[model samples]
Every structure is written in C-alpha cells, then in structure tokens.
Target: MAITSANQLELLQTAEAVAREKMIDPALVVEAMEESLARAAKSRYGSEMDIRVSIDRKTGRATFTRVRTVVEDEELENYQAEMTVEQAKQYMANPAVGDQFVEEVPPVDMGRIAAQSAKQVILQKVREAERDRQYEEFKDRAGTIINGVVKREEYGNVIVDVGRGEGILRRNEKIGRESYRPNDRIRCYIKDVRREARGPQIFLSRTAPEFMAELFKMEVPEIYDGIIEIKAVARDPGSRAKIAVISYDNSIDPVGACVGMRGSRVQAVVNELQGEKIDIIPWNEDVPTFLVNALQPAEVSKVVLDEDAERIEVVVPDEQLSLAIGRRGQNVRLASQLTGLDIDIMTEEEESKRRQAEFEERTKLFQAALDVDEFFAQLLVSEGFTNLEEVAYVEIEELTVIDGVDDDTATELQARARDVLEEQAQRALAHARELGADDSLIEFEGLTPQMLEALAEDGVKTLEDFATCADWELAGGWTTDNGQRVKDDGILEKFDVSLEEAQSMVMTARVLLGWVDPEELEQGNEDEIDEDAVEASEDEA
Candidate 1:
C-alpha cells in the first residue's frame, strides 16, 4: 500500500464510508487515517524521528512531514527530533529554544506487516471514537425511558439493542422473573450510562421506582404538563407499589387524574409493570396525613409522630392491624418508604395499654422524687407534670389549677420539688467528678449537672471532647441501615436534649475552646439567613 496520487482520493473515500457505517464524524475517521499513516511512516523512517501526517479535507491529499523542535543544549535528548538552539541556526537564520522546524517527507510504501499494523491502528481509533460518541449521546438520556430490542441473554443479564448503543439489564434490575428472547421488544428506564474500557455501558432497569413514576408521567398528560407531580413512589417490583401525587391546580384531583378515566391511565402503567398492583395516594405536606393515606384500606385510630427520630406510631383498630401491616409487613414497609418514616403499627388496645403503663411510670417517678403520696403523685401526673423539672419550675397558677390544690399547696409542692431536684443535681455532680469530669465541662452554661454525669459516663470528660462530638451524638437520632431505621442512643438524650439545642451547645463549646472562629460562624449564619429570606420572598411571589 502506498500514498500515491491514485490512492490519495481512495483514502478520503474509505474514511467517508467508515464514518458513515460507524455514524461518527468524517473528520474523526480522517484523523484516524492520518494517525495510522504516520505510524507506518515512523516504521519506514527512524523510530526516533518525529513523523507527522495530515490529510487535506477538500483535496483528499496526504502530506507527510518530519518535525524537529529546538531545545536547550542539555534538554536535547532526542537527536533526530530535538535540536539545540545553536544547532538549529543551520536550518534557520535565527531559532529560539521552543521553535519547531518542519520539513516535508516522502510518504511510506507500507509492506504487508506495516499495512496490517496500520489497519489495526485505524480500527482501534475508530472504535474509540465510536465509544466516545455513544457515551456523549446517552449520558444525558439517563433517568429516562427507552425502547429497545432484546439482543441476547448472557447468564441472567439481558442485553438490549438501543438505537445507537447496547443496554444491559442486570438480573437484579428486572421485574420478578421476567424473561426475554432474542428480538423481543422491551421498555426500560435508563438508570445509568458509564464509559468503560469495553465501551459505554447503558444500564437499564425495569424495577426502579422512578420507572413506575416515569410510566405514569408517560400515561398521564397532566403529569407531563406539570399540573400533577409525583411526590413519592415505593415499589415491590412486579408485586405491589405505592405512588403519592400532588396537584398544583385546585380543580385537578391528583389521584383521580393519575387513576385516569375508568382506571385507564394507571392500567397502562400496571400492564407495563407486569401486573404490579399500585395504590395511588394524594400527597400532603402533613406527614401524618400523608402516612394515613399511604397506609390505605386500614382505619387509623390514632397517630403519634416523633419528629426528631423520624419515627411514627399508628394505632389502628384490632381488626385493621393485619390490614395496615399487610402480608409479611409489605403494606407498612411500602408506606414507610413512601412517607420516608419508620412506622410502628399497633392495635388500639395495645396503645391504651402502653399509655396506661406510661402514666403509671410517671406517677411512680413523681411519688419517689417529690416524696408525695400515690394519690397526690397521680394527680400531678394527670396534670401533665411528667418530670420533677416541670413541677419545680412551672407557674404557680398551673399547679393551683389542679383539684383541691390552692396557692399554698402549689407553693409547698414547688418547694419540695425544687429541693429534690437540687439534691439530685448535687449527687449527679459528685458522681461526675468521681468519674474525672473536668471543671471546664461542668462549668459549661448549657449543660446541667445530670448532663455532665452522662457525658462523663460516655467518656466525654472535657470541653474539648464535647466540642468534638456531633450534634446527633448528644441528641440521639435514627439512621437508615439496609433500608431499616436504626436508633442511635445519645448520652444526653435522657435529658430531652433536642438536636438544635445539642448543635448550639456543641458550637458554643467549640467557640470557647477556640476551635472555631466566632466571626466566621456569625457570617455563615448571616448567609443562611439571607438565603432563607430570598427563598421566602420567592415562595411569596
């Protein structure tokens, strides 16, 4: 093979054909040909020589060149490709250290081995360009639905032929035991697009919650128009699913619109999902209300939410318990996922028993802490005074409002409660000091003596230790582990320390220890306030 006048136009013709076949830019194919020709030219010439090739896009002519760059005397390692400033004077009137001298060179007459190597190089370059083109084309298409034809199955994974690329649907991403044969048409969600050594990988999914949401979007015009929004979706793949939707337009009912006229719209989605049962619920800003709707077909007698823990307790009638929990707890699990909360469902009788137990426990605490009789402690408990702190610091009028309790009785009650609290505090302080608590921690304004004891027991004896602690470590929190909520116990949680209070106390400790700059903290707060104000104004608009 030679770059003769007869074959010069053939190179561009071949490049155009290859580019058309690969669906890539003709310029890229031409560039690949130039690179391959340069590689063959290097073999014909000295390997150290800097050989270059250029193809004229319009004329289809090949130009080969030898390039030698001027360099400092000590930097001229490549004798054929680099020239010292002084040696470069022979080639030009004046040449600087960074100048390059180019001379036209004869094209190579490639032998059988050289031509074969050049062909491989061109093929590699074309493949790389194709991969890049595919990656660029599909990267933005992620999180969307695509129609493809199933090509084959490797092990348990299904390979689909998308228009310009191949998508892989892993066994785990398939709905249930769905199987496909060659040339079977399939609809899937483009879960991800990645560039790899082999090629661009387009991962497809049929079990993604977003897939169901997208299906509804496709079937519902209101959703596509943004009149109705899919707020949340939870699915058990091909078995059961729940979707919560909200409507911005007051006239449009989100649930009804999603269900469509005579269940036609939802039915379309259901058919695509392989008969997956779906419960469409109206989205609500109130979490409990949304949860009640999520756990549909079950009558909720009462709802108790622990906001800080992100946990909810639902009391249903005994007959509805099984219905709320579903078969194998699937209903509650889907509801929890839909609402993003950990739900604990119980019967009304169970809730009553638990409440009675709590009441008895509070009465016991009051009786022991205040040195009051059972009836008096029960009365205090019934008045909503759960702890000695409330009884000690509450308004005199609040205690006086209790039956048979006058101002004098309230005053006596408060006196005794405060004395007991003081004694308990002193005992806690002594215990904390015994456990090697530092004065700096004990003197911290926000932490009570009991808090110090708890901290000392937890090995946080110094202000530095407190400063190093995260807010959740002192306030307790719920963490999602393996899709289940796990409780993290906090040392100060028993003292009813809220997350916000813990954050403030930790920040205060850090400031006192000079671990954080007060000015920077204040500036951050100001920035947050400004951002919040801007958001508030935007919401108002």
Candidate 2:
C-alpha cells in the first residue's frame, strides 16, 4: 500500500466507514489511521528516527514528517532523533536545548508484513475508542432499568445485548432459577458500570431491592412524579418482598396509589419479578409504627424498641407468631431489612414471662444491696427503682409516696442505699488497685469506681492509656462484619459512659498530659459549633 493521490482519499473513506460501523467519532478513526501510518513509516525509515503522520480532515491528505529534538550535550542519546544545541546550529541561526526540528518525509510503501502490523495497530486503537465510547454512554445509566435481549448463558451467568453494549447478569444477581434462551427479552437494573481490560462491564441485576423500587417508579405515575416516594424496599426475590412508601400529598394514599386501581400497578411489578409476592405498606416516621406495618397480616401486641442498638422486640399473640415469622423466618427477615432493625419476635406469653423474670431479678438486687426483706424489695421494684443509685439519689418525696412509707422511712431507706453503694464503690476501688490501677486514673473526675475497675481489667490502667483510647472503644459501638452488625463491648459501657462523655474525658486527659494544645482544642470546638449553626440555619431556610 502506498500513500499516493489515488489512495490518499481512500484512507479517509475507510476511516469514515469504520467510524460509522463502530458508532464512534470520525476524528478518532482518522487519528488511529495517522498513528498506524506513522508506525509503518518508522519501519521504513530508521527505527531510531522520530516519524510522525498527520491526515487532513477536510481533503483526506496524508503528511509525513521526520522530527529531531535539540538537547543538552550530555542528554543527546538518539543521534537520529535528538541533536545537541551546538549541532542544531547548522539547521537554524540559534537553537535552544528544547527545540524540535521537523522535515517532510516521503510516505512508506508498506509491504505485506508492515501493512498487517499497521492494520493491527488501527484495530487496537479503534477497539479502545469503542470501549471508551461505550463506557461514557452507559456510566450515567446505572441505577436504572434497561430492556435487553438475552444473548447467551455462560455457566449460570446470562449475557444480554443491551444496545451498543453488552451487560452481564451474574448468577447471584438473577432471581432464583431464572433461565433464559438466546434472544429472550429481559428487563434488568443497571447495578454498575465499570471499565476493565477486556471492555466496559455493565453489571445487570434482577434481584436488587432497587430493581423493585424502580419497577414501581415505572408503573406508578405518582411515584414518577414524586408525589409518592418509596422509602424502603426488601426482597426475597422470586419469593416475597416488602415495600414501604409515603405520600407527600395528604389526599393521596401512598399504599393505595402503589397498589393501583384493582391492584393494577403492583401487579405489573409482580409479573416482572417472576411472581414475587409484594406487601405494600405505608411508611411512617415512627419506626415502631413502620415496623408494625412491615409485618402485615400479623397482629402486634406490643413493640419495644432499643433505639441505640437499632434493635426491636415485638410481642405478638401466640396464634400470630407463625404468621409474623413467616415460613422459615422470611417475613421477619424482610421486615427487619425494610425497617433496618434487628427484630426479636416473641409471643405475648413469652414477653410477660420475661418481664416477670426481670422484676424478680431487680427485687433480688434490691434485697441484697439495701438489706431489705423480700416484700420491701418488691415494693421498691414496683416503685421503679431498678438500681441502688436511683434509690440512693432519688427525691425523698418519691419514696414517701409508696404505701406505708413516711418521710422518716424514706430517709432511712436512702441512708441504707447510699451506705451500701459506698461499700460497693470501696470494694470496686480496692479491686481496681489490686489490678495495678494508678491514682491518675482513679481520680479522673467523671469515671465511677466500677469504670475504673473495668478499665484496669481491660489493660487500660493509667491516664495515658485512657487518652490513647478511641471514644467508640470506651462507649461500645456496632460494627458491620460480613454484612451483619456485631456488638463491640466497651470497658466503660456498663457505667453508662456515652460516646460524647468518652470523647470529652479522653480530650481532657490529652490536654492534661500536654499531648494536645488546649487552645487548639477550644478553637476546633468553636469551629465545629459555627459549622453546625450554619447547617441549622440552612436547614431552616
């Protein structure tokens, strides 16, 4: 092949044809041709020579050039491509260390081997450009639903021909046992788009919770218009699912709108999900109320929520227990997912028994700690005094309100509770000292004696050790491990040390040890407050 006048126009024609076939920019194809021609020219010319090619976009003309750069004397390595400053003076009146000298070169008459190599270079460039184009086209389409034709199945994975690109629906992402032959129509969620060595990968999913939400958005006009919002979704794909929705317009019932007239809208989504049964629930700002709605078809007798732990206890009638738990606990699992809480479901009888057990335990603690008889301890428990601290520090009027108890009796009860607490504290302090606790930690103003003993047992005995501890380490926290929330026990957690208190105590220790500047800490706190104030004002606005 030669870059003659007859073939010069052919180059641009071929570029246009290839660009049209690839659905890429014609300029990119032309650039690829230029690079391939340059590579061929380098083979014809000395390999050491810097050869370049340019194609005229308007006229389809090819221009070849030989380039040599001026360099410092010691930096000149390639004699054919680089020239020293002094040696470049022959071509110009004055040449600096960084100057390129270009001269026109004759086009290469490519042989069979050279032409084949050039063809490979152009193909590689075109493939890269096509990959880039596909990535750009579909990147923003993620988190959306797309219609595609199933191309084939590799192992359990399905490959779909999503116009202009290929999407992969992995086995785990498919609804249970979904099997498709070639050319089968499929609808899937664009879960992710990634650029990889082979090509841009468009991962599709049929089992994502978002897929069900998107389906509702498609089938429900109110959802698409933002009148109804899908607050949460949980799916056992191909089996059962739950969706919680809310309506901003008071006249619009979110659940009714999602269920549609005669269940038309939800039926459409259900049909697409391979007959997955869906329970549409109204979303409530109150978590317990929302949870009650989530576990539908089952009556809830009581709901006890531990907000800090993101856990909930639901008491249902014994007859409703099986319904609330579902077959194999699926109903409760989906409800938990929908509400983002760990649910402990029990029968009303079970909850009552547990309550009674707790009452008996509190009575026992009061009987032992305050030296009270069983009846007196039971009376104290009934008065809502669970621990000695409350009994010791509560107003005397609170105790006096109990039956057969006067001011004198209340005073005597508080005195005994305080004395017992003091003794317990002294014993805790002694045990902590035995565990090598220093006075620096014992005298820390906010920590109780029990906290000191816990810290010492956990190998954090000194003030220095406390200063090095993270706030979460002292106040306990929940961490996600393998997609499950695990509890991390904190040394001071039993002492009711909140995360904020732990942070403040640690900062105080750091300041006392000269490890952190008090002025800087104060300034940081002021800055945080100012930022918070700005955010609050913006939210109000």
Candidate 3:
C-alpha cells in the first residue's frame, strides 16, 4: 500500500520497532534523520543554501529552516536571497551589506521526487549508522574465536553472520580438505574488522598462525596466564603443525602442559582442526638445536651453518633421510619456515664425501707448498694439524716427543720454522713502520734503548741489518764486559727475550756496534804476545 500521512506515522513507529528489535538506540534514528535531511538539501540546493533540520522526539518527523543575510543592497547575497531588508529588520536593525537573515522554507507539497529522495537519504543514513554500530561491535573481538552461522558461499568464500556483522572466510584462508555446510556452526578467529559502504566487513581466518596459538591458549591456561610464551609457530592448516613454546617458570614443561593428560588437551584442538596432527616442541635459543627440533620425526646427526648464505646443512643418517625430509619435503619445508633458514638436508654419506674432499684439498696444499713428507703429514692428520698454523706453531719439545723425531731433528725443524716466521715478522714490521709504526716501536718491550744504541753503532738500523751481517754471525755471540764472548742465549736472557728475539735484536745491534777490523785484532794480539820474539829475531840477524 502507498504510504499516506497515516502510513508515514506508521513508518516512524515501525522504525522505532526495528531499532528496538535490533537493540539499536532510538536517538540514533533522530540523528540519522537530521543528517539525511541536511544531506538532501545540500544535494538538491547546493551547500551554499543555509539549511537546518530538526527532528521531533515523539513522532520522529523532520522540519527544515532556511537562513539568510540582511544587507543594505537590494541585490540579495546567497544567505539573504529569500529575504528583504524589511523582513530581516525585525531580527537585526540597521542591516548592512553582509548582515544575515532567517526564514522557514514553506511546507512544500508531498511530491513523489522530494518524498522519495528524502526516504532514500534516510535509508542510506540508517545503513551507515548500522554499519558503524557493527564495526564497533566486532572490533573489540579481534584475535578471538567466534562461533559463526554460515550464511552462504559466494565465489568460494563463505559468508558468515557473527551475531552483529557478516564476516568473510576467504577461500585462501580456508583449510584445505576441510568442508562446511550452510548454517553450520563453525568457530573462526576474528582476524580484522573494517567499515565499508555496505556494512562492516569482519575478515576471518582458519589458517592464521594465531589460530594454532589460540588453540593452545584454549587448552593450556598457562599460555593465557602469560607463564608460557609462544615463540613461533608453523602450520600446514589441516595436515600437521609445529609450535615452538617456552615457559617463564623453570618448573613447567611447556610441551607437556600443551599436550595435556593422555593428549586430551591437544586432542581437543586436533578435533577442532579436523584431526590434524600437532607437534609441541620446546624452543631453544640455539639455532641448530631449534632447527633439529623443528624437523621432528627426522633424526638429525648434525647441522652445519653457512651464516653468510643464511643456510643450514642438516646431516641425517641414511635410514632417516626420507623421514627427515618428509613427504614431498613438507617436514623440512615447515622447519625452514619455523627456523627462518634455508635448510638443505643431506645424508651422512654425502656430508662425509664433502668432508673428504675438503681434507684432500688441504692435504694437497700441504704437500705441494710446504714439502711435508708423507710420514709427518700422516702425523699431522692424526693430530688434527690440518693447517699451516699447527706446523708453524708446534713447540720443539712437543715435536721431539713424536716417533722418528729426536731432539736434534725437532730443534732443526723449529729453527727452520722460526727462520720463516722471523722473515715474515720482519717484513710485516717493515710494512708497519712504513704505515706509521715508528712511534709504536717504542712500545716494544723486547727492544731496549741500550740495545737500540748498540745496534745503531753496528749499522744494524732496521730489518736491513741482514744485508751487512751473515746469518750465522747475526745468530752468534754478544760481547761481555770482561771481553769474553757470551753466546746469543746469554744475551737473550738479559732482556728476557727468546733466541729468535735476540736475532732480531742482533740485526739492530749490528748497526749500533758498527764493523770492527779482524786484521787489527790479530796484529794487536801479536803486539801483546811477542815483543820478546821481535828482539830475539833482531839478535839473530
């Protein structure tokens, strides 16, 4: 039936009825009416039109008023177009060019266009208000499970009514192999709430990480109480899931608590997830160990990390390779996601081959570059001395204890190694001094000022000291105060430096000592020994 004046009154009453039924505030209807009327006037007459709308509390009817400006000029301003100065004088005397005027728009006939337009505006306003209400209702419930009645499926997405609003469970968010029927009461986590032109859009998810986290929360009170912290979670939705958990209190086992007695707690979650399996593993700060746990049912022998590449190579026994890798690599794939690493799974045989290749390469370098004999090389291999560092650093005493290596052999080998090391050290020192180490040399406790002076006189100013003296002479004795020649070892003890250190000192000392003539020393000895022999020869002549 056409809505007559009586029908309009009934419409207002019906609006009140619907508002009450929906638990919607009646005042919101009045506000919506005002807004709708204002919007209609603005749309029809432009916003420059000064219009105000008032709503009746009892009848819910709307009244409109138009405002104008009083002005001196007969030409009406936008706000004074409907009024004359004489009409505006009652409200404001001595009206100026910009003065405002007020009047009520005459009650127009209830034409189809105007009435229909107003009704449309009121309906739109009501919908907007309803949408806002729904948004507020659902926003606070985010991250919690809500039981929803399935409305329909559109484009593979399930539309569900969540009491006050409709939520969309997108196809991508639905668990694979899980089914639902219309009107089915399924529980979903409220992932988000958003306002739109039609209504509030509540987005739901069945595959979110929080879904599993919430399942644990429901089963384990400790999780809700904050005693346990869910460090990270990985899932395949309906198949299997891995959740890493930790407990603040040392006494509680997070995995055990989450599992519950006879698996009842976890079973409850599993049933809700449609018989999906769950592994509640304890979290560890150690990355390798955490990764091993993440790849459960698969035994991991060891995990080798390549930090720069952000990858980890996991070694599994030949028997467990398939288990560790899982069907179609799902196990290792989820583990990679959980541990945040690119995991490469390998069998013991493969890793052993890699280790063997590395060893062979190192051995080749030792044999080719270091001239290490087969016997000594085997000893180095057995002793874990794979690199040049071990050979260069092995002590003489320790080397002497090895079979076929006596004290003399050990000493000679140590001396050769020392020579190589000293040469390298001198070259480094020279480079360092070139790079500004002149002042830093003073910090060397091995080089005393007295020793430096002695070296200065012998023309042994720098590592260049090797240029003037033989290795044996530089490696030889130091002169004592009683004119006795003490060996380098004795001179080394004076400064608490080693023989190699004394050699470095001797290089410097040669410069300080300068060169003494051997011929002059021989003649001086003759002068002291045979002044009498000279006289006897003169007598014989």
Candidate 4:
C-alpha cells in the first residue's frame, strides 16, 4: 500500500495494516504519520519554523498548521515563531500574551523519498510501542510458568513464541535430559523479564529450584490447595532433588501426601522433570530434625548443633557415613542447601575418637595452664572449661561451684588464667608495634590487643582502615561471594568480636574519624550540622 496517496482511505487502510502487523495501536500509527508529515512540512517551510500536523481519524486527511504564541512586544524571543499582541490583533482583536494562533496550510503532496521516510518513522514508532506492550505483558508474569512453542534454536538456546511475544530459554536454563526441535511445546519458569533496546527479553528457566517447586505445585493437588506447603527445594537439575514440605493439618502427613498413592503424584512430577529422582521429606521448625529428615535412607544417631555459627555436626552409624554423605557428597550438599545450614557428617567411631582427643587436650591445657593436678583438671574439663579464657572471664561464683574447688582456690586459679592471657597480650602488642601499628589505634577503646595484631598482620595499620572496615570484616563470617556458604572467618574472628560488637566498634571508629556526627545519627536527622570545615567529610564516607 502506498504511504502517500490522494485517497485518504488508502492512508487509513495502510495505517491499520501496519499497526496490526506491528502489534501496536492504529492511533499510534496515525500519530507517527502526523509526526512524519510534520517533518516533511518543516523541511520545505524552514526547519526553524514551528509547524505541526494532524490527521482526521475517520477521513484520514492530513492537515498542516503554523503555530505562534502571541506575546507583548517586550516578551517576543523569536520573530518567526512569536508575534506581538499588536501584530496578532490583525487575525483576532485584543490578542493577549500566551494566546496561541494557528493558521491552517494546505497539505503538501509527498514524493517517493518522503513516503519512504514516513514508512521508516511509522515502523520505528510501532516497534517502540510493541516493546512497551511486551514489557508490560511479561513483567508481571515473572515466576509464573509459561507455555510456549519452540520457534527456533540458536547456539542451543530455544526461543519460544508465547503468543503475545517471544520467550528465551537460554541453553543453560534447559534441562540436561531435554531437547527440542521446531514447533515442540514446552513449559518453563518465567525466571525474569526485562526490556532492552532490542525489545523485551523474557527469560525462561528449567533448572531453577523454583521451577521444580512450581512443577510439584501443578502436579500435587494438596500443594496447589495450600494444605501442604513446600518449605524449601534444592535441585541438581535432572540428577536428583530434595524438597521439604509441611502440612498445616495434623491429620495429613506431609511426606506421604507429597509422595501420593504408591508414589503416583511424585512420579508425575518426576516424569515432567525427565525422570529425575525426588526426595520429599517432612519439614520441621527444628533445624536438626529437618536436617535428619533431609538426609533420607541414612539413619542419623545424633545431631550436635552450633546455632550461632549456623553449622551442624551429624553422627551416623559407621557403615552409614558413606550413605549419609552420598556419592560425591551430593546428599549432604543438598541437605545443606534445603535446610540452609552447613552440615558436617561423621561416623560414630570418628566422633568418639574426636571427642576423646579433645578431652585429653583440654585436660592437659587446664593441668599446666592453671597449675592444677590431673584430678582438678579433669573436673574443670568436665565443667566445660575448654580454655584458660573461659576460666579467666567466667564469674568467680561459677568457678567456685565446681566440685572440690573452694572459693580461695577458684580465685587463685582465675588469677593464674588472667596472668597467662595478659602475658600473651603483651607479647602480641610488642609484635604489633614493631609492625608499625600506631599508638592511637592501640589506645582505641573497643579494640583489644589480639584484634590489633590481626589488623597489623594484614597490613591494616592505619586508623583509616579500621574506620572503613565493615562489621562482617571485623567480626568475620561476612559473605564475600554470592555462593551458598562461607567456608572461613574474617580477620577479626581471631579477636573474638561478635557481629553486634563489631558493628558498635565500626560506629565508634566512624565517630572518632568525625565522618558521621554521633548526635545526628542518634537523632535521625532531627538536628544537622553545617560543618563544612571538617576535612575528608563524605570524601571517604
């Protein structure tokens, strides 16, 4: 269809066809045409002149107008696009400032090049409109399962056509066991959708743990009805997966319900996952119990938990250790992910050997360090005094309560422990100072000698590094990477700073640095200082 024609119906029909083909509103196409015609008109009428074009929706006839705002003689900025009120009075009497005058000009018939330019403008505008439409259509669909037909494959990535737009299932997102040719139907999790310069990129994922959870939700009626809830899921993508489920109703067993009659329900989900094995376990609020359940087919004898550290030690029968850890540690690894805790597995024999070694070491430490006899050392070890620090820092009343230990002996023992720690602190301080640690840092209130040494050893000798250190950096356990777990402590862990205490210490350093006014922080900006003279203010903040 010709973009430029004397027949106005042809223009309207062309707009309708282009809008339908581009999946945009026909009115937007007409506006684009008006903009294009305005460009053509301005090219002939001088680019500096303010020219506008409007198209009739029904008749499709195009009209051009030259617009000028009437202003007082003193207010005119441009002579071509602005007119004085006295000059405007020729068209309308008593023209006032800010009044606009529009004069209709006859439509200029376009040549072939102008028509092509109009088509390009229309196509560009339609594409922009289609992108906006696709963004709005797919943005809310993130996390929902979308069904689409395979449109094509590029570099092993499947591009699916999902009616309103195309969705991309990146190669990494495809399940290991699945392959598709053109026109094959597939369902994928709408992992994310975003607008880009090329158009909307609707990303699909099949390997996401959420994708398996979504599949279970589709296959299990109880899960779909919200009676049984999926607490957490971890998948090795077509290899194996573990899901923790909980039922609100006491009469319904969550695991049995998820497994279905003779495993039919779970088998259906497994079929969809391309024969991936699934282990559905009951969820418990107690993490240890949940972890025990998470590691199925292997019996757990006992679980020793360190809640503050978010780590669990599970002891199983000697023969079950291999089974509990699974082949290549996959079972325990999935358990860690599903329970959100780091798991350390040991055989009963291994644990017994470890406990025996720890008992002997602690006894020896207490025997020599506290100058106590073997019997007294055993008593202290039995009382859970693992190190001299516990004996030094614990209350005198706690020490005196130990069997065969009087108040006087407890006091002497505590004094000896304190003396040992102090002597070690002095040696560490001397070493730190030799490493160029400043006196000001050593004298800082919250910092201890060991913390100072840890800083010095790491080349963080200045007050600036202390001020800039994060709570996690000081207390350790700061997650540096976005991986599933952290394997080591930060440098400040040697100083024994809790996360809360580390936060306080960092705040103290900031106050000492004068970066943040303490009063302003406490009052939440109720009062602020305009102290512009403070050096490095916010330059390092």
- Residue 459 C-alpha lDDT in model 3: 47
- Inter-residue clash pairs, candidate 4: none
- lDDT by residue for model 2 over 268-334, one digit each (tens)? 9999999999999999999999999999989999999999889999999999999999999999999
Tens digits of lDDT, candidate 4, 171-288: 8998894889999999899999988889999999999999999988988888899999999999888889999999988999988988889998899889888888999898999988
User: Which lDDT tens digits does candidate 3 get at residues 1-541?
Assistant: 2223454466567568757766677677767656656656655556777777776666645566776765555565554245567766777877665666655664334456666777787677677777878888888999999898999989899999888778999998898856678999988988988877667889999999899899889889999999999999888889888899999999999998999999999999999887878888899999999998898888899999866346799999999999998888889978987887778899999999998887777667556545667666566556565655456678766676677889887666656655665665566555544444334333444565544444444445544443354534433444446633343433224334444555554444443445435466558658966987888899999
Return model 2's CA RMSD, one decimal.
1.5
- Clashing residue pairs, backbone N/CA/C < 3 A, model 2: none
A best-first ranking of the candidates according to their TM-score comes to: 2, 1, 4, 3
Comparing 2 with 3 on lDDT, the higher-scoring candidate is 2
Q: How displaced is residue 286 in candidate 2, in Å?
A: 0.6
Q: Per-residue lDDT for 69-151 in model 1, tens only?
A: 99999887999999999999999888998899999998889999989998999999999999999999999999999999999
Each prediction's TM-score versus the true structure: 0.96, 0.97, 0.64, 0.86
The best-first sequence of candidates by lDDT reads 2, 1, 4, 3
Find the 10 residues in a row with the least total lDDT in model 2. Answer: 489-498
- Those runs of model 4 whose alpha carbons end farther than 4 Å from true positions after fitting are 1-6, 20-23, 70-98, 392-412, 418-469, 482-492, 509-516, 524-541
